[model samples]
Target chain A: MRKFAALLYKDLLLLVRDKAGLLFLFAMPMVLVLVMTGIQDGAVENSSKKTVSVLILDKDRDEMGREIISELQRQDLFDVTLADSTQTASEVQQAVKEGSFLIGVYIPENISSMVRNEIESSLSEMLGLGSTPQTDTLSSLKVFIDPTVNNTFRTTMMCYLREASNHIEKKALLSTISETAQEFSPFPTDSMAPPPDLKPISIDEIAYSKDAFRTNINVTEHNVPAWTLFAIFFIVISLSGGIIKERQDGSFSRLMAMTCPYSTYLMSKIVVYECVCVLQFLLVMMMGKLLFPLVGLPVFSMHGAFALCLMIVFFCALAAIGIGLTLGTFASTHQQASVLGAVTVVVLSAVGGIWVPTFLMPPFLKAVSVLSPLNWGIEAFYNVILRDGGIRSVLPNCLLLLALTVACTAVSIVAKKKI
Target chain B: MATTILRIEKLRKTYPNGNKEVLTGLDLTIGQGEIYGFLGPNGAGKTTTVNILAGLLKQDSGNIEIFGKPVASDRKNTMRRVGFVPQSIAIYPELTAYENLSVFGSVYGISRPELTNRIGKLLDLFGLEKFRDKKAASFSGGMKRSLNLMVGILHNPDLLILDEPTVGIDVQSKVVILEYLKTLNSHGTTILYTSHDMEEAEHLCTRVGIIDGGKLVAADSPEALARRFPECHDLKSVYLELTGKELRTMED
Candidate 1:
């Protein structure tokens, strides 16, 4: 016990003395959290809660075109605006192309008349009357979308516009049919009010997890855990460099020659570095919860699962330390350890959904992401913070992280024997 | 003979992925209270022999007994009686001189009071008292070497192994280190030293063992080896006559 304490004390002293290293360890993650959340929050709002700007170039000066614009505004997804009268079709295209508005609708002149004529001709043919000749001019609604918009949002806006136009056409056709029936029938059409057109099926969205609390995945919630895990895993560079230095300087050999087993030195490193990892996590989390709101970002919350969230962080630290030990044991020099450790951490972060969310990745990448320890860490964090899940929910991810720690530590020990 | 402090019979080693054996059937013994100079050229299996005794390595085939207990069976307890000063400066540069000694002393299981006393005594003995609170990184090369030697002897092990402990230092520092080894020997500590400097070994070692090709070629006092090779005037001449003048390079 005394020997272990001595070893631990020595390592902690070294860490404390390296003021630059300590500052970088804590500050870099905080900066990443703030910068990443600030950048991603705008994107999150644009895709979900924030309204998309839509421009209307209504040339028809008719009821149909007006009704479509009104319908678009009524929906919560779009903020409709009237385009300048002097703006030509080319001007409208340039505006949309420049991303002044996410979408632009061009309602051609006489669109209402064209629809009515088509309806009359169809009705005349159906009633066995002689059909009127079709008009030579063709008028249709044209939509202009900004090229920069993501495909998913573009598809959604297109679907909504199509549905709005179709609904208006159906209403006009129904009114025409009703008027024709009133003219031919003996009974008055207004004797009794018609029932409202209520659809037979409606959809209600429910929370997918056990908790009924449906939360938005704001940037704060997403970035805090991701950057924290990144900072934690990046400890490999420092830890591995320390190991290589010890080996090169002969401190490792001197300790090995002593009666104190080399395992004590390794255990001391694990204990100290793991604590540093946890401290890094807490610092970044505090930055998100306290400092983010000051910068106009959402406050990061764990959904009241603080204890469970910390458990995941602890497991994440172990996994990180395991990798550091393995890297330090195998790498022959400080440069090799540092370069390889940094590259490995970056690759892991890339595949683990730290830089990009897994849901947005392709299926193959998402499948590969599950193999990364960072992915397991972020998933566990999401379960507790985003999904409002319980211990049972995060158990699988935590267990996987624990397994990684065991495998890496085992490999490090075997490698240390060879060293 | 005095009690055998360390004994090795038929020790052999070949590193993994290595084409040649580093040590082949090497045999040696050192008695208590003897300053034995184990001499060899570069890659003559000198450091390899010391590393095996220090338990930093395992022999492929050998019988090693330290203090009458098999080293293979009881490495932990056996190593408690050994101290190794590597050729390189091994002390942590970031740590203060006092802190370095305190740490190694504590790990050697010395009590806090005893450790403080020993650290103070060592700092004074090595003329490092003024730099005790300073970081080792700021020390000159000679001071760093002294601190390295001080760390090895912090626990005052029964068998002290020095591998070129004074190499690359000024003559004054070298003399101080060589003189300290004599003082340590007079206090009944068995010493196994390896170095390329022949004059220092001749003046310091009670007995000298000249090894080549993983085998000891001559074992006697320096005076006797010089007399046996009548044409050689000193230990260096005797060493050259026995080992040869051609430059040799081997890696362990």
Candidate 2:
């Protein structure tokens, strides 16, 4: 035990004395986290959530006009501001043209009456109680938008208005039916109501909105753990490079000359790196889960996130050490160790969904990503950080990481024997 | 009658490729407190012999005993009592002189205070007291060599095996190292030294063995070996007379 502690302490002291290495170890990952998060958030903010502000002019000042604006605001996708009582349709359009809002709309008087009249006449003709209804020439609603506005936005605004008009027609029909039944019976009969098209496609939209919200992934949750683990796993390069230097320069012989079992030396290497890796894990997590809120990202509850992170990071360190030791043992030169170490970590990080989400990857690459250990690690992080998963949710990822550690460490032992 | 410190009988080895044999039925012995010199032409297998004796290599067929412990049966016990100075500098360059000594001493299982004491003593003995805290990376070649030798013997082993410890160094540094070896031998330490410097070997060795083509061609006092060859002026000529005038180069 004394021998083991001495060797471990010596290596750690040597690493700490290297100012450049220490700087990279502590500063590089923090900087990468901030940069990557900023970049990802930039893409997310730009590509999604096209929030539009609308200036609404309600000339009718009726229930139908209020319902349209209320429904738009209820979706939480638009900022709906009512026009002043004195503002005209031209004033609303001018406000939109002057860059006050992305969209402008006017609801003139008698537009609600026109929709109600159309529904009643159509229902009466369908029932053969009157002649075929004449289609009205009066426009019901007029919208003005910036010419630079995209067609998608135009289509979205048209859909909202169409739905709002349909809802008002249904409400007017229901009220007329109730009045007719009040004259004859106690309850409104189904025959008194208008056609089936007046009914909504869905009576309840709350459930849909709840699910639609999940479509937007929080970039911070995904970026924090993915890049943090990516940086931590890169210990393979530094660890392997250090060991290969000692081996090439014949300093390793000094340890062998002392009758110090090579196994003990290998263990000390693992211990020292594990210590460093765990410390790195804590430092990175502090900035990720703790300080993420400063940048408008929600600070996920630390309750279960800590254990999930610790478990995965521990095995990740072990697996990283295993890779480093195996490569250091097999490589005949310092360059071989460094190049192989760097390439392996880089390739693993790419396929493991660190840089790009697997869900967004092409089919074949996504299928092959499962073979990467980093894939399992990043997946485990995603489950806890983004998916609101618990300990049981990440069991498979944790077990895979541990299995990789065992297999890699075993192979490294075999390789070390040749040395 | 000096007690025997190393005894080898019928030791043999061959390369894995089987193109050439490294050691063939070689035999030798060294007594306690003896400064034994090992001499050979190129490819004479002096290094192979030293490697096997130091327990770094396993001999295919042999019985090797160091201080009555069979090296093949008890590798750790024998190696713990042996100190080796490889031809290359093996000390950690990134470590301070004191740190290097402490690392080796601790692994040898020396207690903390004793290891500390030994580091101080060895640093002074090598006249590196002022540079104790300095890293070995910036040290001169001779200072590194001296520190390299110090790390080997820091555990105070009974038998020290030095393989060309003075290959590249200044004359004054070489003299300091040689005088220190003489001092160590006088204090009841057995030394096994291999070098290409014939004059140094002729004066320093109590007994010298010359090997050629994996065979022990000569083993006797330097004066005795020189006397046998009347045509030679010294051990240098005697070495040439015994080994041959032909170059012993192997094809790459």
Candidate 3:
């Protein structure tokens, strides 16, 4: 322990003295989070500010049609445009397909009257009256969505339509029940009776994460973890260079001639660099939390257990340091280590969903992404921050990262012996 | 009658890269308190032999005993009594002179107070006390070399192996280093030093070995070797007489 402490202290001194290394570790990540979050937020804002143009064909032309139109308009994401009475369903579909509108809704003719008749018949049957015969009529709502719209937007649009349908049905059912009770009243009831305010089934759309107010992940939440991981893994460049420097300068040879085990030297380097990675993460996160809001971006809010998030970050740091140690051990010179380390990190970031979301990647790249330790790190972060996942959810990724650390450390140890 | 500090018998090494045979059945031994100068031209296996003695490289086949125990059987314990100063300036450039010595000293399991004292004494002895707080990268070549040497001997090993310890240094630093080596030898520190400078070897070595083509051509006191080659005037002439005047600059 004493010898390890000495080695650790020496490495720390060297790291702090390297001004360029310190800057790369801390400053680079902060700037990346801020700039990337700003850019992504601007894109989000532009897209959201231009509301989706929705065309509605109300063949019902009654209470249900008006209620649906009013409800769709209440949503901030939609721009509801009522179609002319002469326009057909095919015309609305063609308009949406032509990109004139993002979505088109068609309400069947006499749909509100059918709903009122169905509720009244059900109520009369419940009161021991005979059922009334009804004519066959179209009862389904038809919606046409632009194929270019992504699944998330399509799903959100469908959810809002369903909500509107539920609201109108509930309103019609209560009014029918109130009217029926008045006709069959045994006591004299005043005309000032308040309408039933009962809501049998209300559906509220919310983000699945810990924060109920968060309808969806914002730019800050997405970019902060992604860029921070990229910067953390980038510690390889400086760390591998340091290792090669020690070998070329004969410090490694001198140390080998002593009574200490080789593991001591390797451990000292890993411990120091891992600490630097953690510090980099904290610095970037703090910038996202405090500095981002000042720059007109949303604050980076963590939605998972803080302790679990830290554990994932800690494992990620270990994996990054392990790669650094392996690169330094195998590389003959500083240039070789730096170049190979940088390229490896870039490739990892590329396939690991750093530049794009994993789901957005093609099939082959998405399959390959699982092999990257950075991918594991980002997935784990998403699980905690975006999914509000607990230990049970992130345990697999954490274990995989830990396994990578062990494997990489093993390689380094074997290579150092040969050196 | 002196205690044998190091012994090697039938030592052999063949690098697998180009199947190059660097050492072939070489035998040598050094005794306590003897300044044994190992001299060779380029590619004569001087660095390889010293690296093996320092536990930096594994021999293909050899029997090496230091302090009367087999080095292979107890390498860590054997290394505890040995110190090696490599040809390159090996100190951490980003670290202070004191820090370099302290780290290396701690590896030998020295107490903090004792290591500090030893580091201070070494710094004063090497005329590096004033630069103790300065990073090795900022030091002159000679000062860096001095700090490198200090790190090697921070634990006061029983045997010190140095490879070109004074190369690329000023005359003043060279004189001080030579004087210090002599002082260390007088205090019973066995020294195995390798150098190409015949004059420095002739002045400092109690006995010197001249090797060429992976074999020791001659081994004796400088005066005795000169007497043996009566036509030669000094150790350099004796070396030339035994190894020839051909240029030896090829890769070993």
Candidate 4:
């Protein structure tokens, strides 16, 4: 026990002296979070230019069909394409299914005449003179929609299409009434009522959210936790380098030459690196809490965030230290340890959503990202920062990170034996 | 039974890279409190033997007994009573000399109070007391080497092995180290010494073993080996007579 304490103390002393290492471990991540948030927020500012692809299959090919298609094109929200005449409706549906088009609009045959006939009958009935109202009126349009489209985008497209149909119907009715009122009215000419003022459909919006980040979230809410985890795991580099340095300097073998247990020496290194990682995590998170909101980014706090964060920091450090020790034990030189360690961490970070959020990744990549502890960690952070969730929300992620830590430590122990 | 401290019989080791044997059925014995010189050229497996004894590497075949206990592959308990001052500078440069000694002492199971006293006494004995608090990184080569040796002997092991301890130091520093080692021997610490300096070995060693190509060619006192070759009066000439002057630039 005393030897372990001595070993741990000495390791801590050496690590504290490495100023550059500490900076890279803590400050680098904080800076990265800020920089990435700034860039992503700039992107959010120009989000109105986003586009969704729509394919139109106009079998009606009439004045009403052309007008409705023109109105949709005018919205500037869609990259509109008219379907090829060579393809059947089923083929076009297949295209939509394959994600080639976000939505497909198929207008039925004679839809313009059908709409006109319905309008004329309605006018005649109101005048109490002429044919009965048509029972089969064309009011529905066939829309082949991509099921995987964003909910917001799908809602906007559906509303636009509905408004176009309503406009066509209203224009068709008003014309029919103007023509018939002069010729068919039995009431006195002066008593003929002016067309009732058409009231445009209006929407009233109400919001009932009490959560802070429920209304909207910016890049800061995502990046602060993301890059912080990324930065903490990068300790693999310095930790491995330190071990390789010890081996190169012969202190490693000298330590082995003593009567001390290998378990104590190995455990001391693991403990020290874990402590350093936890300390860096706290420092980065504290910076996020103090500095992030000042920059006008969305920020929210959940109760028990501190304890949950500490648990994450510990498991994350353990996992990173495991890799560090494994690489250290196998690497024969400083260059070997540094190069291999850096490559490994960079790859993990890439898949783990440091470069891009796993939610936005392609289906396959997103599925693979689930195996990345960094992705798990980012999700836990998002639960708290965006959903107002607490420790209970992040428990599963913490457990998985712990499992990875154990696995990595096991590999490290095995490798340490060969040395 | 001359109170043997170490016994190696038919020990053999092959390098991990294969195709070569480093130690080939070598045998040696050292009695209590005697300075036994291990003389060999480079790549002659002296360090390999010491490593095996210190539990850093395993022998392919053979047995080693220290104080009647078989030296287990790990040398865990047996190592507590043995010390190895390696050829390289093993002290942590970032640490102060005192800090290095304290840590090493604790590893050998010395209590903190006793370790403190041992550090003070050993530092003063080696003339390192004044520089004890300074970082070892700033020390001269001689000071580093001296501190390296200080760490090994601080535990007061029954058996102390010095692997070319005086390799690259000033004559003054070398004299202090040699004299200190003699004093340790007088106090009943069995010494296993390796050096290229023939004169120093001639003066210090009670018995000598000449090893070449992982095999022992001769074993006796300097005078006795010299008497075998009347033309060789000095230990270096006697060593040359036994091991030859062929340059061993490659592993055997």
Candidate 5:
């Protein structure tokens, strides 16, 4: 026991003296959290109020073409632009290709003539006057609508065109049919197929109201806090180098010569590393509370949040130390130990939802996350911060983390024996 | 003999590569209150013999008895009576001199109060009291050597094993270390020392063993070995006459 205390004291002294290393271990994570939050928050805000540009090619000089262009301008959904005659199809295609225009519409010529022909044909058919007239004028008129427009925009424009065509056709038919009826000396104008009467149709458009889709969730509130927990866990792996150093320096052999059991030495290391990790976790949390609010996250009751954080920190530290011990036992040099430790932490953290949200990952990847202790840590953080969970809510994650810690420690002990 | 503190019989160590034998049927016994000097040129297996005795390396076949108990049978029990100061500086540089001594003392199961007292005495004995608070990193080569020896003796084991304890220190520091070891031996502590300096070995060792090619060529008092050799007038002459003037270098 006295020997164990000595070991602990020695480790603490080494840590204290390494001021630069300590600062990096404790401060770097908080700095990363702050920087990451700022960037992500800005990006999310910018994406919510997205803008789409559109190019319009008006070929028809008629009133119908002008009305269509005006209708597009009245709607706020698109930033509309009129392309001049010199701006050929190639230029419009290039703009669309370059992503400058969300879409492009080309109005064809003779659209007015097609509308007049449709009115004459409909009135003549209704009055049974002259044989049914067929000429292909309507087909030419259909070409005036841009075929490249998206379905939503195209439908709106078609609706407007149809309304205008109905009004023009009705007025032309009413005047021509009534004048013919009077010249033919009819008993009443109604006798000539009701004088090809025109009826008015009501057109109503209900514009959709745009809602503010962007919310004010702070960067730290989303995932940075969880990543901070993961970073602390990674630092625990660096402590494995201490064990390798002891072994290389012959201190381990010297201690063994002093009648101390190998088990005692390993346990002492685990205890010291766990303590360091817990301290780091607490420091990061305090920094978060002081700094997170400055970045715009809502400040809530820190008591429950800190409690959940501590529980996760404890389990993560235990597991990380166990991993460190396992690596230390097998490594022959400090470099090898550091490499293995870093690789293990990175792979685990990546799978554990530290880098990518588990929700965004595929099912298999999410299933693989169960193998990572970091997953439980981040999940615990999410429960506290996002779900506003208390101890009862985070209990399962806490239990799993604890179980993992025990399992890793056991595995480390076994590996140490083999070494 | 005054109670044999360390006894080894038919110690054998063979490397796995080419089945090369490093220690071939060697045997020796060390008595209490005696300074036993193990001498050999480089690659003469002096370090291997010391390592085997210190329990740092396991021997292929050997029977080691420390304080009349078999070290091979129960190493932990036997190791409690022994303290090892390796040829290299094994103390932590990041820790202060006092802290290093305290840690090493505690490893032998010394209590907190006893460790504090032991550490203070060791620092004072090595003349490191003034620099006790400073880290070992700041210490000069000789200071580190002194602290290293101090840490090894902090627990006051029955047998202190030192491998080249004064290899790299200044003359003054070497004298201090040798005098300290002699003082400890006079107080009934057994010592096993390894060195290549013939003059120091002749002056300090009560029984000197000359080993060459992993074989014990001669074992006796330095005067006896000199007297036995016809042309030898000093320990160096005896060593040169027996082992020959050859530069021994290890291949692997």
Candidate 6:
């Protein structure tokens, strides 16, 4: 055990001196979390483009056009304004050109007559009563815009036109069918009166609740914290270069010549790597708490967050040590071990959702994620932070991580013997 | 019957590729505190012999007894009493000389106080006390070699096995190392050294064994080998007379 302590001390000393490994394992991941979280918040905020002002020119005085105007006003995306009849193509163009409004819609004077004609034509075609429908009612609703408005305005206009066309079609169908049917003499006048204005569908605008809040929280909040946990594991794999260095240098054989057993040396490595990983985990979590809120995540409870983080760090440390042992056994040189170590970590992290979200992945990829420790770690973080889950909720992931640690450690020991 | 520090009998090793025989029916013995030199041309099986004795490589057929205990029966205990300084620089270059010594000493199960004392003594002996805090990587070839040797001896094993210890060092470094080995010998440590330097073997070894074609050609005190070859005055002449001057190179 004393011998192992010495070995562990030496490994820690080497790790302190190797700046490249330190940066790759600890600093780089922290930086990545900061950058990724910032970008994610930016994307979410950009997607929610609040209120857009719309100019409306209603040439038709019919009730259908009036109904369409009222409907446009109801949607929160648009702030609709009616334009006078005197407003010409140039005047409307100037208003859009001056950037007073984001979009403009001009309803033609013959719109109601056009709807009537379209319904008749469609009925004639379906009944084989006349030739095919003549007018393109759907095509005429297209708005002419100042091309400078670009695709955003074009897309919004297309959406608006589509909604209007649907309403027109429904209203026309009701009018046409009722004209052909008998008058509604069976129902009493009081009974025929329209039902009291049904309340508008109440949409809860609350982006998050205390219980379901985590799902609505931006990726930066969950991903950065989770990545910090992953970074600690990565550090373990990276620092394993010390073992390979000792082996290549013949220092390990020389050590074997002494009273120390292979078990002591191997155990020391596991201990030192676990310590480093845990340290990294704590540092990054602290940094996340301090820095990530600027990217839009709410302040999280530190006690539960850290407790979950510690469990992940422990698991990662074991995995790292196991990987180091495996590499030490198989690698002929420090360079070989370092390269393989780096490659394994990168590939594992990619599959584990460190680089990408598992939810966005295909079903097969999600299933494949089960094989990676990162998936369990992220799941654990989600439960803790999003679900407000306590120890019981995270217990399953913690157990799996512990199992991985044991399995990896056993394989590492067996591999060490072979070496 | 003075307790034999090392004993090998009927040791045979064959490479799987090309059916090459590296060692065939080799037998030898060394008593305590003896500086035994194993001399051979390249590929005469000097390294293979050392590797087998060190338990780093398993021999196909052999019986090795160290301190009256069968090597295979209790390999770990046998290894503990032996220190091997390999041909390569086994110390981590990134570590300081003192740090390397401490790690190696710890691996040997030395107590902290003992390790601290051993490191200081080794640094002073190797004339590396001033560079104790400097990383081994920045040291010259000779300094690195000296530190490497120091790391091997930090545990103070009873039997020290050095494989080409002076292979790639300057004359000054080699002299310091050889002088240190002599000091260790005077303190009753048994040493088995392998080297191609005939003069070094003549000066340092109490007895020298010349091997050729994986077989022992001569085994006796350096003076005895020289006296037996009437035409030979120096150890080099004795070596050439026995193993021939032809270069032996193997195709891997």
Superior candidate under DockQ, 3 versus 4? 3
Residues B1-252, model 6: lDDT tens digits: 457999988788886564778887778888898899999888888888998887766678879999888988988777877888888888888889888888777777778898898888888888899999999999999999898788778778899999999988899999999999999999989999999999999999998888777778788999999899899998999999998877788521
True contacts kept of each: 0.81, 0.56, 0.85, 0.56, 0.68, 0.75
DockQ of each: 0.81, 0.47, 0.63, 0.52, 0.52, 0.60
lDDT of 3 by residue, A1-419 (tens): 88899899999999999898888888998888888888989988887776778999999999888878888889887888999988988999999989999899998889888887777777778887677775356398899998887676688778877877777777778887777777778767566375566655667887787777778778887888889889989988888899889888888888888856788888998889888878887887778778888889998877536678778888888989889888888888888988999999999998999989889999999999999988998898888988878888889998998898899999988876775
Best to worst by DockQ, what's the order? 1, 3, 6, 5, 4, 2
Off by over 4 Å in 2: A49-191, A196-217, A289-304, A387-390, B15-18, B244-252
TM-score of each: 0.92, 0.78, 0.81, 0.80, 0.77, 0.83
**Candidate 5 lDDT, tens digit per residue, A1-419?**
77778777777787778887678777777666666666766676554444446677666667556766787677666578888966655577677767667666555666656666667677677777875568465533231223455565556556655765555556556666666567677477556554444555567553221213323334555555566666767664567777788888877777766767777787777777677777776665666667667767533234357767777777777767766776777778878876777788888888988777787789999899977888887777767655657788778877887777677667766765444
Q: For model 3, what share of native contacts is present?
A: 0.85
TM-score of chain A of each: 0.85, 0.67, 0.69, 0.67, 0.65, 0.73
lDDT of candidate 4 at residue A353, scale 0 to 100:
87
Show the colliding residue pairs in model 5: A108-A144
lDDT for A330 (candidate 1): 89
Specify the highest-TM-score model's number: 1
**Selected candidate, larger TM-score, 1 vs 6:** 1
Model 2 agreement with the true structure over B85-181: per-residue lDDT tens digits: 8888987787899888888788888899999998888889889999999999889999999998998898888999999899899998899899999
lDDT of each: 0.86, 0.80, 0.86, 0.81, 0.75, 0.75
Q: Which stretches of candidate 5 lie over 4 Å from their true place?
A: A56-218, A297-305, A358-370, A387-419, B15-19, B72-74, B241-244
Query: TM-score for the first chain of model 6?
Result: 0.73
Q: Show how many residue pairs clash in every candidate, following the order shown.
A: 0, 0, 0, 0, 1, 2
> DockQ winner among the candidates?
1
Per-residue accuracy of model 1 over A1-419 as CA lDDT, tens digit each = 99999999999999999998898788888888888888898777667776778888988878678778887888788888898766767777777898898888888888887887787678878987677798556577888987776787678777777776676667667766766777677887776344334352667777565346553466777799999999999898889889889889988888878867767888999999988988888888888788888888988888788899889989998899889989998899888988998999999999999999888899999999999999999999888876767899889988898888889888887877776
Between which residue pairs do clashes occur in model 1? none
Clashing pairs in 2: none
Worst window of 10 by summed lDDT in candidate 2 chain A: A204-213
Clashing pairs in 3: none
